[model samples]
Target: MVDTNRITGAAKDIGGKIQGAVGDLTGSKHDSVEGRLREAGGQAENLYGQAKDTVRHAADEAYHYAEDFYEQGGHSLRRGTREVSRQVAEYPLASLVVAGLVGFGLGLLVNASRD
Candidate 1:
């Protein structure tokens, strides 16, 4: 989306240029200086709008990237869960032994932490 500031600034810059040109032709130093100052201000405003646009675009890209990463991670986790379930179903005894060992190891870790 184009920033409103950019459009207004461009219009202001054009008006300033016209004013300055007219001032020069009519020999009005005050008008010339004021016009030039206005032009400079317009240019600054335009730059600010451009900066805002750049930052917004960058943020949008980052958000999309994170969303994609999260979706991919979820799929991987589901696949891993299915694979583990299949393995356990195919070897119930081995799975049971492994689960008991894991529980025992966790108990030791918890005791160590308490100490």
Candidate 2:
């Protein structure tokens, strides 16, 4: 979450540049190799950061979609309940029986799906 790779990459890049400069000044092969390795590490870290950013964006989009679906479902339930209640007012007994049967069937289906 903190994007440590990105931070490390930046640090490595700067460190490599400094080390490479020093190696050049002192004519040291070992220092040159170390510097190149550091630079490679930094580039890898930068790539990782980009990948993390892409994943974060995708997760955010998925969360928004789920939230939208939940909100819409709640609204649909409320509207359906209101309409059903209005219909029930016109015929109490038949509506009650039908509603009970529908609820039982729905419950059974839900339970079956969970299994």
Candidate 3:
């Protein structure tokens, strides 16, 4: 969840930079090619890590929204049932109507808050 690949990618990138710097300082062609290759590989890895992070974030957001919506629906159902039971025991038609209205408003509020 913490994106280990991204961390690894970053380390690779830094290592590549250091290697490239060292190769340049030492004037070694072999080291220079190796360094360039490593740098390219690291850049690719960093791009991949960024894509992965984006996907993970989107998925997490979707999951949270679904969970919140489900919980809100469940709570609304429970409250509605309780209100109906109370209304039935207290006042017949009036309480029923009022309870329904209140429950509806609460449901709307929950939905709005999710948005």
* 1-115 per-residue lDDT for model 2 (tens digits): 5477888898998898889878878999789889988988898997898789789989999999999999999999999999988989988999989989999999999999999
Best by lDDT: 1
Q: State the lDDT of candidate 1 residue by residue for 1-115, as single tens digits.
A: 9898888888888878888888899999988888898888888888988999999999999999999999999999999999999999999999999999999999999999999
- Model 2 whole-model lDDT (C-alpha atoms): 0.90
- Residue 103 of model 1 has an lDDT of 100
At residue 88, candidate 2 shows an lDDT of 91
Please provide TM-scores, in order, for all candidate models, with all chains considered together: 0.94, 0.68, 0.61
| Per-candidate local distance difference test | 0.91, 0.90, 0.86
How many residue pairs clash (N, CA or C atoms closer than 3 angstroms) in each of the candidate models, in the order given?
0, 0, 0
Candidate 3 Cα deviation (angstroms), residue 110: 36
Residue-level lDDT of model 3, residues 6-98, one tens digit each, is 777778888888888898999987787788788778878878988988999999999999999999999999999999788788888887788
Once fitted onto the true fold, the runs of candidate 3 whose alpha carbons sit more than 4 angstroms away are: 79-115
